[model samples]
Structure formats: structure tokens, C-alpha cells
Target: MSEVNEQMMPPKVVLPKLEKNLYEARAIKSFLLTAMVWGLVILASIPLFSVIYMLIVEGGARLDWEAITALPPAGFETGGGFGNAIVGTLVMVGIASAISIPVGVLAAVYLSILEPQSKLATTSRFLAKVLTGFPSILAGVFVYAILVITTKTYSAWAGGVALAVLMLPTVTLAAEEAMRQVPQRMRDAAFGMGCTRTQVIFKVILPTGMPGILTGVILAVAGAAGESAPLLFTALFSNYYMAELAEPTASLSILIYNFSGMPFENQIELAWAASLALVVMVLFFNILARIVGRSKF
Candidate 1:
């Protein structure tokens, strides 16, 4: 009976191959990963596509060569453009870029390369971050107090200064980050080659980091171009073309602000057209930045 019971007992089971199940699990994981990636892509695309669609629908019909060349008309009368505003925007943004790029890049070089561990560098870096987050309106107010008040008049020069203040930290931090991204090994190799510090930096490091630094400058300029609050306080608005840097200037943003609220359909249309042009300007700068970032040399 005992022998019969032992014979009826279950035999030791043989192990099945785990490799097949493992491969199946891996396939499932890969599929899930692909699905997640596509899901995120679709999620991100919704808002971007929506903005582009809105811009086209609302502004496409209003865009014309006149919009780019003629002075805006007065009152409710139709048949005008934002030529002065476009030109003023360019002039002010150019001034801001000229001011910020050199000072910002020099500060970045000092902080990132010269004396990174010094107290002054730390303070400068901290101040830059603070300024970067400072309110745009406050920048306007600051410039208004300093320049406009001193000069007793709002001018394109004041507007340019305001934009320069806004752009300084952005350019400095971006440039420093770009410089930091240069491989330490490359720096060491330059040193091993008996290159002087200045030689290595100017020849090797700056070249390697130019793409990112230029990208930052381009983006900063785009942001400066779109700003209305600072220009409102500093540049004011002019019905005519800018005659001098110290005179009030027209900009696309201020035009949009001035026109969008007017109880006139003509002005409203001009606003939309100006808005479209501003959007195109910013988009072009972004594209240019991307191209620069991807460029080699």
C-alpha cells in the first residue's frame, strides 16, 4: 500500500524556458514605451497647432504690403498701416541688443571662466537670476524713473535701455551655461598643448560655445521686440515716423495695444495685422536660433 501511495505522488516538475517569457515581456515594454512617447507628442502638439491656426484665421486677410509700409491712419478712417511701428521696433531692439550683448557676454566670461569661485562672481550670478525673474512692468517703471524722468521726456533711447535691462540677465546666464558645456577634457588638452588661458578661451572655448550663446541672444532679442509695457512707459507712442532716438517711437506692440481697444473696426484690423507681423518676427528669430544651434564651425 505504501509503495502504491509513493507511486501515485506527483513527480518533480521540469523547469520551463524563461527566455521566451522574458522576450515577450520585453516586447510589451517596448510597445508601451512607444505608445507613451506618441501620447506625449500629441499632447504637446495641441496648443502649438491651436495658436498657429488662430493666428492664420484672424490675421492672414489683414496682412499686406501697406501694413508694412504706410503710417497708421487716425480716428475710425480706414486705409493705414504700421510702417513706423515696425521701424521703431527694429531700431529699439537693435539698440538693446547692442547694449546687452557686449556687457552680458563679458560678465558671463568673467563669471564662468575668470573667477567662478569668487564672491563677486557668486553675487553677480545671484543678481542675474534675480533680475531675470524681475517683473517686466517694474523694469518699465525703473527705466521710466531713471531715464524718462531725468530727460523729462519719453524716448526710444529710454525704451532701448529698458529692454537692455530686461535682456542682460537672460543673455549672461545663457552664455555662461553655454561656456560651461564645453568639455573639461578639451580645456585640459589645450593646457597640455601649452596654450595660454586667453588663447585657449578665445580660440577653442568661444568657438565651441558660440552656437548656444547666439541662440540665447536671438531669443532675448525676440522677447525684447514683443515687449509693450516697457515701451509704453519709455518710448510712448508716436503717430508719425521716428525722427530721432530721443523722440517718442512707435512699435508693433504699442500699436496693438493702442489699436486693439479703439472703438473702430479699422484700428482693430490694423491691430490684428500688427499682431500677425509681430508673431512672424518672433517665429523667424526662433527659426534662426534653431539653425544657429544646429550649425557646425
Candidate 2:
């Protein structure tokens, strides 16, 4: 029994000691790599931080209630605001969103779910990828040629159309990718339960993918909101408040572009403030996208 117990006992454990020099070398290499990564991150962040700091210093000085709620001043005028531009931006963006979201989401559904292997779907996906890199100025020119010329005036409607064109590709591609991320098991289960394709898409896939879809939509909206060139060609910058979408409209980007070149100091200050406001708006949309992306179905 004693012999058996001895045989069953675990052998004496041993841990080999690592060489001090080799351990030190590995530790140093890891530290150096970590430092390099951090250095690169900080170096890349410098420009972004500097721009934000500059905006706060310059724009914060001129940002106030009047800036938020008053009209922009003339070149010689000293105390006015860009309230009309704010309203115009919201209206145009709203129009763009209204036009883009449903169409884009539905197209994404067709591409990712209904007819994914179809030649038309392949062509659409290719064109969408191409449009992702398509120049913003070209989009502006296209809208100018089509909507602006047909309307006989630069209007918010034209600007919204231009932005919609720019936004569509983003929304479509992102939503399609999001829908594809839905697990195949879910689709199979839905089919096993005798659910129709449309029913499965609407009831199972869309609900599961809502967070990602919202993220894409918000990101597209953020990109569209900051566009200046399209609005320049389409809306043409109104001085007074816009009473309708069919007329010229003010926007923060246009305001900044127009005011930054002026000889007047106040207008320049207003431009700075508008730039700050525009940045905040874009940042807010980005943050919203992040929050939505993290949400549960």
C-alpha cells in the first residue's frame, strides 16, 4: 500500500528560472513598443486637439444667445447672429434624411436579404462603393445641373437633393453590411417556423439590426450636415430667414465661408462661432451614433 501511495504521488514540481538578461530584453522590447504606439497616437491627435482648442478660444468668445437666435450682421454692422443659418441647416438636413433613410434602408434590404445574388444587386453594390468615393464637388455640380437649373433658382430643395445624393451611398452600404451581420441561424429559425421572407426580414432581421442601421443613418446625417459646396451651388446663402424650402437658405457652412473672407472683424468672429457650432453639431451626431451602436435590440 505504501509503495502504491508513493507511486501515485505527484512528482516534485519544478519551474525553470528564466535568464535575467533574456527577460530584461523582452521587457524592454515590450515597453518600447508600447511607448511607440502611444507616441504615434498622441502625434496623430495633436492636430485634432489643436483645432478644437483654437475653436473654443476664438469661437467661444463670440458665441452667445444672440449668436444662437439673431440674424447675421452686414459687413459694417457689429452685433448680429447666424440664427437663420441654423434653421436652414436643420431644414435641409431634415429633407435629406427624409428622402434618404427609407430608400436607403429598403435598398439595403434588397441587396443583403432578398436578392443578394442577383446581378442588379451586384451592380448596385459596386455603384454604391464607387459613390462612397465620389467627389462632393461633383455631387454639387450634378444637383446644380439638374435640380437648380430646373427650379430656376438656388433653393434649399436643391441643396437637400444634393445632400441626399451624397448620403444615399453611405446609408445603403452601411445598412447592408449591418443586415449581413445578422446571424444565419436567426434566418433559418424564422424559416423553420414557416415565416415568409418578408415577415422574417421585418420581424426578425430588422429588429436585430436596428442598432447598426441607426448608427449608419446618424453617421450619414453627420456627413451631410457639414457640406458647404453643395449648399453653395444649390441654396446660395440667404441673408434673411427662409420662409420656404423653395427659396435661398442660409447654412452654417455657407455662413462661415462667406464671413471668413470679409474685412469686418465682427463677421469674422461670427464665422468662427458658426464653425464652432457646426463642429458641435457634427460631434453630437457622431456621439449619438456611438450610443446607438452600443444599444441592445
Candidate 3:
């Protein structure tokens, strides 16, 4: 009876040992690859960190509330600020955003949802892609000829138009991509519930893609804010406050460009401070985009 009971017991199972040589070889390769990737990342970050450090050291030294709210100093003046430039920059950027966002978003909607495969959409998409690589100076020149020359003066309106052209392609492409990412089931569900195409777009697609659209708009605004060439041709420069959109305007970028080339030390210091301020504005827009992207509808 004891022998029978012993025979009925389950047999012991032994697991096979893993090959240490193979495992160690894979582990070494993985470690080496990871080390190489980290090395490359650090290498790429050097220039960026260096630039930020330089800006902080040079630009930060001159940044102050007075600098933020004061007008640009004259060539021989010792104590002045760039308040007008800041205001002008904001005005022109706001104008550019107002002009570009509506037109670009509409174009994006047409291309992505309404008639994606149409010949007109294809041509437009191609043109927009081409414009993405278009020279910023050329945009300035085009607006210069069309608006500045026709109106017989450089003005914030011209600068805003030039910026709008540069911003349009980016906004259109980004918004289209964002809209395309909307799930097909969402569209189907909307339709199944008796929603019209336009209704679906406004209610479902636009809300879902708002974050991406905002991101593109903010990026375009940031890019427009830093552009000196276009503003040079279109807005020229103003020492005093801007009175109207039709008047020449001051901007942070143009201030930096003009100030940096001056023989005066004070203006050069103002340029550094303006450069720092422009960098901060761009950083702020990027942060806003991040926050918008993470928010739920």
C-alpha cells in the first residue's frame, strides 16, 4: 500500500537553465546601444544649452522693468527701454494671428474633411508644403511690393500681412494633420445619430482637434514674433509708440537687429535685453501649447 501511494505521487519537474553566454551578450549589446543613444542626446543638447546660458548671462544682465516699459534709447542716450517695441510686437503678432488662424483653419478643414482627394485640395496642399520652405525674406519682399509700396508706406498692417503669409502654410498643414487624426468611428457615430457633415465637423472634429490647432497657431505666432526681416521691410521701425496699424511699428526682433549694429554700448545692452525678452515670449507660447495639448475637451 505504501509503494502504491508513492507511485501515485506526481513526478518532479526540473526547469532548464538559461544560457548565460547568450543572455550576457544581449545584455551587453543593449547596454552599449543605450549608452550610445544617451551620448548622442547629450552631444546634441550642448549647443542648445550653450545658447540658453549665453542668453541668460548676456541678456539677463540688462533685463529690467524699466527696460521692459521704456522706449529704445537714442544713439547717445544712456538710460532708455524698449517698451514700444514690446507693444508693437504684440500688436503685429495679434494681427497676424487674427488673419491667419481663421483662413488657415478653414483651408485645413476643406483639405482634410470636405474634399481631401480633390484636385484643388491636392494643388493647395502641394503649394502649402512648398511655402513651408519658402524664404522669409521673400515673404517680406512680396508684402513690400503688394502692401507697403501700394499703400506708399511701411506699416504694422504690412508687417502683419507678411507674417500671415509665413504663418498660413504651417497652420494649414498642422491643422489638417490634426483633423485627420480624428477617428473614423467618431464620424460614423455622429452620422448614425442624424448629425450632418457640417454639424459633425463643428461639434466633434473641431473640439477634438482644438488642442493641435491651438498648438499650430501658437507656434506660428512664436515664429512671427521672432522674425526681423519681414518687419524690417514692412513695419520699418518706430522710436515712439504706435498710433495706428497704418503706422511704422517697433518690434523686439527689429530692435535687436538695429541695436546690435549700433556703436553705442547702451543700445547694445538694450539689444541683449530685447533678445532675452523675445526668447522668453517664444518660450511662453511653447509652454501654452503644451498646456493646451494636455487638456481634455
Candidate 4:
């Protein structure tokens, strides 16, 4: 009876297994990869935070009401602000955006959607890239020679045009990249649903790509806003509020540059203050871009 019961007992099941050394290697590799990633993250953040900390400590003390609303005081005297400079910066940046956005987005659509491999598209892309890599100072020089010299003045209009030139290639390249990121399968599905090419472009593609395009435009404007060299050649400088695009205009960057190297203590303080303001502006735009790009349709 005992022998019969033993024969009827269930057999043990065998489990599939990897070699022990293989498991150890994988675990070590994962640990190394994670450590490298965190190490790089820490390294990258240190300098950025250091700069922000310095700006806050040095500039926060002098960020007063006058700094926002009064004209800069003359050398060695200290009782004014950057009201006009802020206005001029906004005006020129506005004009640049107005010129670049529509034209750049359209060109991107033509290249990425209509004829990506065509000779014209290729040449257009190549030139856009060339412009992107072209020195910002050269952009100022080019506009100086053409618009500033032709108009016979260093005017806000010329500054805006130079910024637009700087913005155009950046916007176009980024927009093209964004458009290409839209899934081909999605386009095919739209077409399969009886959508015309125009409908597909406007209704389908544009909506999906809008956030990325907006991000590119925001970055372009942010860079242009901090530029002093281009504005120097084009807008020159104004001690008074900007009365017209046809006249000299002041900007925060120019104010910072002029003040930072001054012999007077007040000018140095104001330069630090302007630096802080410029940093805040750039940081705000960057945050806004991220938020806008992440928004749902």
C-alpha cells in the first residue's frame, strides 16, 4: 500500500532560469547607467543655480520702482530708471515676431510637407541653416549697411528688421522639425477619411504642430531680446522714451552694457539691476514656452 501511494505522488516542476553571472552583469550595468545619469544631472545644474544665486543677491537690492519707470540718469548722477529701454525692447521684439512667425511657419510647411526633397526646398533649407549659423554681429552689420545706411539713421525700424532676420532662420528650422515630428500614419489616416490636402495641412497637421512652433518662436524672441550688438548698430541709443520706430531706441541690454563699465557706483548698481531684469525676462519666456508647448489641444 505504501509503495502504491509513493508512485501516485505528483512530480516536482522545473523553473526556467538565467545563468547567475548573467544576472549579476545586468544588475551591475543598470547600477552604472543610473549612477552616470545622476552624476551628469548634478554637474549640469551647479553652474546654472550658481549664476541665478549671484544675480539674485547682487541685483535684488536695487530693484526699485524707479528702476522700472524712470529714464536712466546721466553719468555720475543716479536718480532714474529704464522705462524707455523696456518699451523699446518690447516694440522691436514685437515687430520681429510679426515679421518672422507667418513667413517662417509657411516656409517650413512648404519644405516639410509639400516638397521636402525638391531642389528649391533643399536650397532653401541650406540657406536657412547658413543664416542660423551666421554671426549675430554680422546680422547687425548687414542691416547696418543696408537699412541703417540706406535710411541714413540708426533707427528702431532697422533694429526690428535685423532681429527679424535673426529670428527667421531659427523659427523656420524649428518649425520644420516640429512639422516633421507629426506622425506620417496620422496624415495617412486623415487622407483615408476623405480630407483634402489643404484640410489635412490646416485642420490636422497645423494643430498638432502648433505647440512646437510656438516654442521655437518664443526661444527666438528671447535670444533677440538679450542682443545688444545688433541693436547698437541699428537702434543706436536714446536717452528719452521711444517716440517713433524711425528714431533711436533704448533697450535693457544696451543699458546694461553702458552701465556695467561705468566709473560711478550708481551706474554699476543699475547695471546689476538691469542684468537681473534681463535674466528674469529670459527665464519667464522659457517657462512660458514650456507651459505652452505642454498644453493640450
lDDT of each: 0.93, 0.95, 0.93, 0.90
lDDT tens per residue, model 4, 1-297 = 999998999877898885556358788898899999999999999999998888888888888889888999999687788888889998999999999989999999999999999999999999999998888888899999999989898888899988999999999998999899999999999999999999999998889998999999999989888988888899988989987789989999999999888898888888888889988998888898899889857
Best by TM-score: 2
Alpha-carbon shift of residue 162 in model 3 (angstroms): 0.4
For all predicted structures, in order, the TM-scores are 0.86, 0.95, 0.92, 0.87
Regions of model 1 farther than 4 Å from truth: 1-47
TM-score for candidate 2, please give it: 0.95
By TM-score rank, best first, the candidates go 2, 3, 4, 1
- Between candidates 1 and 4, the one scoring higher on lDDT is 1
Quote the lDDT for 264 in model 1. Answer: 94
- How do these models rank on lDDT, best leading? 2, 1, 3, 4
Per-prediction backbone clash count: 0, 0, 3, 1
Candidate 3 or 4, higher TM-score? 3
Q: Which candidate, 2 or 4, has the higher lDDT?
A: 2
Please give, for residues 1-297, the per-residue lDDT of candidate 3 as tens digits.
999998999998898996657358788898899999999999999999998898899889989999999877778889899999999999999889899999999999999999999999999999999999999999999999999999999999999999999999999999999899899999999999999999999999999999898888888888899998888899999999999899999999999999999999999888888888999999999899889877877
Candidate 4 yields a Cα-based lDDT of 0.90
| Tens digits of lDDT, candidate 1, 25-59 | 78889889999999999999999998878778777
